[model samples]
Target chain A: MAYSGFRLIREALTGHKGWKPAWRDPEPQAHYDVVVVGGGGHGLATAHYLAKNFGKTRIAVLEKGWIGGGNVGRNTTIIRSNYLLPGNEPFYELSLQLWEGLEQDLNYNAMVSQRGIMNLFHTDAQRDAFRRRGNSMILHGSDAELLDREGVKREAPFLNFDNARFPIKGALMHRRGGTVRHDAVAWGYARSADRYGVDIIQNCEVTGFKIENGKIRGVETSRGTIGAEKVGVAVAGSSGKVMSYAGLRLPIESHVLQAFVSEGLKPMIPGVITFGAGHFYVSQSDKGGLVFGGDIDGYNTYAQRGNLPVVEDVCEGGMAIMPMIGRTRLLRMWGGIMDMSMDGSPIIDRTPIEGLYFNGGWCYGGFKATPASGLTFAHLLATGGPHATAEALRFDRFEKGLMIDEKGAGAQPNLH
Target chain B: MIIPHPLLGPRDAQEFVYLGDASLLDRPDWQHPEAGSAYYEYLYLRDNPAGVHRELWFHEQGDRSWLVVTRDTTTHEILSAELASQVALSKEPVR
Candidate 1:
């Protein structure tokens, strides 16, 4: 049933017994027009946009575990479009635009809070780089502001501004960037897709693809064989294993990225703040817990857990900027495997295989790209080409040496 | 996790810097006829297995040696560790 204020009031008067399941748990069908592997945020979003935008009704999203069970549910939940490169900035700006209107469009409360994100700069060179990045954002029609030391102090007075080694110099503030309820994004898309006759089959692991000649006929699954004309795999870290089914290797590595949350306390942080000299970013959740994360564990692993060094290093970064968090008890921490692409950008392109498509290599930034990834993948699946904003996220870019290396880290996936 | 170094005793994992799949040791010749695809595969693609695999880790802060550590990606368990140079020498013929 559609959620509305009138419906809420009537349900409240009737003891709120009128609510139903958020989405349907449908069984796999014999055949579908499109099949999306991995029902994480991107896969669900792809199915949602495929139905809502591209007018493809016969779509099925097969999840090995369940929706929101992967990196979608484990990330720090921060979203932003404060990118520097032309190849990446515009696509993320489009994602930010979609996030702005997501709640109204989905008719589900995804809790997209644009409280802003401030990327702190600690040195003169970093300030100049942020200035150039801000100009690029402005040129891309995205809002960006260069704030001085006083501006940061006015908002966040608790920061360690007088530290000897890395004093606060300035920051680039993107007011449209913030956090969303990450798992709710998956649920919202699942429910929206189910309402439009899309099947969301949980526990249905795709074992292999049923390719005949150059085209796909369907997929082999743990449950049973299901048929589809086109298959798109957005299985995040599993990009390696899943694509191997089609006998194709990818320019991707699976590495573990860990995130941390502190025990709930009184509201302390104002918006998201990232360290310039270190690999740390933090924001306060609605429950008053400080949500934060840092660099991925610099190794190749499919394990959804990291070691102590990265944890200690991230805590050190947190202490370097905001010392108050050092006192707050770290309640819990977890890890998720990121599909670290060679150039640290994402790919939403058709593979050499006729009907098989791929979308992954998000590195450490997949959570923010859910909407755009979905819409663009849906566009590619329905129209047989990438969305205009995501044209540069192609497979051939690597061979052509046109890699969209945002960090300039060269073939180092861990550095990106 | 602790890496049992081939030369040294068990050392803390913090002292090492990870480079990726040990397959990187197989650096293709730059002047090969199909260097384009060879370098592309060598540099980008990875078989990031979910089970036991070998990877390169530089002891940047310890003994300053490179070791190929066989690890299970699912459990983060170190299966074996060997000197990287020894492993490379075992693979290559005398020049």
Candidate 2:
């Protein structure tokens, strides 16, 4: 399949005529049906779905940078519905289903790979946890396998058997989980949404929201003030500040998550392996480099730079799992800021602010949830109620003490 | 010492070190003991072969690193190896 995400973006950067729409009306518009902030994946998807499902075609997606320049372009690109939580599982499952049909839906190939994701378990307690997680997925109509020690060896024989340390045991495998070309997914949505008549305005930063009598009228942007009946805050990392300008405080924290890639080698790993006991996960990209990541930088900061300890720790994990990789040199690393919610799940709902909608608090799993998130967030925007699966992600759930804590572990104050 | 399972190929006992039972690895800071186990498991395969062949005793208690003395399981042939070179720490006895 043609991975034209970079190609399209390059075309836009070269001052392509079709890069943006010329405003027929130079002055501020009286009102638009909808205005979306942040032309990243979620914003574009929202505009696309809004037009497709709700007949709301008069929409504007204002981006501060080039489209998809945010976390949409910076993620590790893993996609799966292996969640065991209540609200997260079904919504992600819908996303996985959409991902399977994305090529046909958008007429664009995203290079979606269902190569599987395996979570290794070292202790009996961890194994038991995996068993429960597997069972949970099965109960929810998703595929999950609980592999024993011999099964683990069969799946990944390269693992070290004994030295004087942690033993090789079993793993929980989600065969439907895999990766996609992240930038392609974004560009596919942008192009498809543009075809649907959604105006994608680049270099347009939302300076402040225009509200009157407790209802949002539109947004004032760097380009110019645009009027809209409804406004959606789809900005992920910059969400808090955007909503703050509207006099709203959200339960969201911004943190940086780092990902690393090693120099290209012949493909050694065919699937994703997550170190459940340790804070690391790795997979080999089609380009032959070993791609991996770890937990978010514990501190609260928007700077997309991480400390060296996490990088070293994640690399050490790769070497421990596959000894041959110790010889591979790391090429480069980058970080993306994430908007982590208190409950570690996304919040996509109508806020208390009249005519203002939100789709933030994606944590690290937003890439996988793009399709379903857009579909459902649009549903709420048009109908004023959440899509069935997104009911738990409402902003009111936090105050009502009804957080959908899927990890079972209490929300990590340090984590999202 | 029998090779653990189907995944591991049968090599001469001379390739290993017997450091004794896994005791030195029983700490939380060396990373959760489970992590230690996973690390050592990978170490056995990647490290260059040394010590006696058959019967290896691993001693993990002293400095949290393994000390293996390898000997042939059948003939008790002592192999040429020591614990000094495998780890960064010294195995010298402290007064």
Candidate 3:
């Protein structure tokens, strides 16, 4: 049913029971034109664009578990395009543009807020680096403003500006960067794709691939054999295992990253604020809990739980930036597996197999890149070529020594 | 996780820094004929299994020694930790 204000008001006046389930629960079909493995945000978005833009149908998204149960629902939900590299800046800028109009496009309230994000700088060298990054963002048609120490203080007065060790110097603010309701994104894209005749099959796990002598065919799953002409895999942390089913090895490792939330308090943070001296970023949720996270647990593990060392390390980083956060009672902590690529960047290109495409290696940035990742992956599946913006995220870049190492941390998954 | 160290016994997992797969110790020969593909596989490809995995961990905060630790990725259980230097000397060097 198409939803509108008039319909909502009419239902409210007359006993109010017109809402429907967001998407259909259809059984797995024997054959589909294209099959997307993984029903997280990126896979659903890919399916949405494939039908909406390329006019392709008979697509099915097979998820091992329920939708939005993976990193999509577990992420910090902050979105921004404040990138600094030629290969990455324009792509993320496009993602920011997509987030700007996402609610209307999906006909769902995804809550794409432009409350802004500020990256704090502590030292002269860090300030110089941020200025260069801000200029690069501005050059790519993104909004960036350089704010001095007084300016940052005016925005966030509770920060530890007079700390003895690390004094706040300046900040780079993006007025368009903010948080979105992460779960709503998954539902919004799934419903829109279902409207375009795409099937979202939940509780269906892909076990193996039926590749015949270097050509595409279908997949062997827990349900049964399903045929597909093209297959795209966007399983975030499971990228290694899923791609290995087709006899392909990826330059990726799985690691655990934890996120935390504190007890509810009155609104304190203006928007997303990241610490420059350490790996800490935080924002206040609508429910008043302080949402924050830091670096990945520095190891390779598929286990979705982290150790005490990282928890201590992240809290130390947070306390160094904002001292007031220490007094808040810690409420909950959870971990999500991250697909840490060798180059610290993502891959969105066709694999060595004829009709198999791969889109992963997002590290800790996948949540922000959902919309653009979906659009570009759909373009690659439909048109057999990388989108102009995503052309640099090819797999062979590592083989050719052309890695787009944004962090300049060469070949280290955990460091990236 | 606790690693039963070769020199020191039962050290906390937090004392070491993780450097990933143990296969990295077998760095490819730079002048070999198949060096191009060898280096590509060496740098990128991996048998990143969901079960048993042999990895490297540097005791940066402890003895500053590197160890090839065998562990399960699924459960994060440490099976063994051997000093990387001794392990390297014992193995047949790759050509």
Candidate 3 has a DockQ of: 0.83
The candidate that achieves the highest lDDT relative to the unseen native structure: 3
TM-score of each: 0.98, 0.75, 0.98
Q: Write the per-residue lDDT of candidate 2 for residues A36-144, one digit (tens) a residue.
A: 8888888888888899888887887888888879898888889887887777788888888888888878877788999998888788888887888788788877899
* Candidate 1 per-residue C-alpha lDDT over A232-305 given as tens digits, one digit per residue, 9 for 90 to 100: 99998889889988888888888899999999989878899999477888999999999999998878788899
List the lowest-lDDT window of 10 residues for candidate 1 chain A. Answer: A407-416
How well does candidate 2 match the true structure in TM-score terms? 0.75
Cα deviation in Å at residue B84, candidate 1?
Answer: 1.0
Candidate 1 clashing pairs, residues 3+ apart or interchain: none
Which candidate number maximizes DockQ? 3
Compute DockQ for each candidate against the true complex.
0.82, 0.01, 0.83
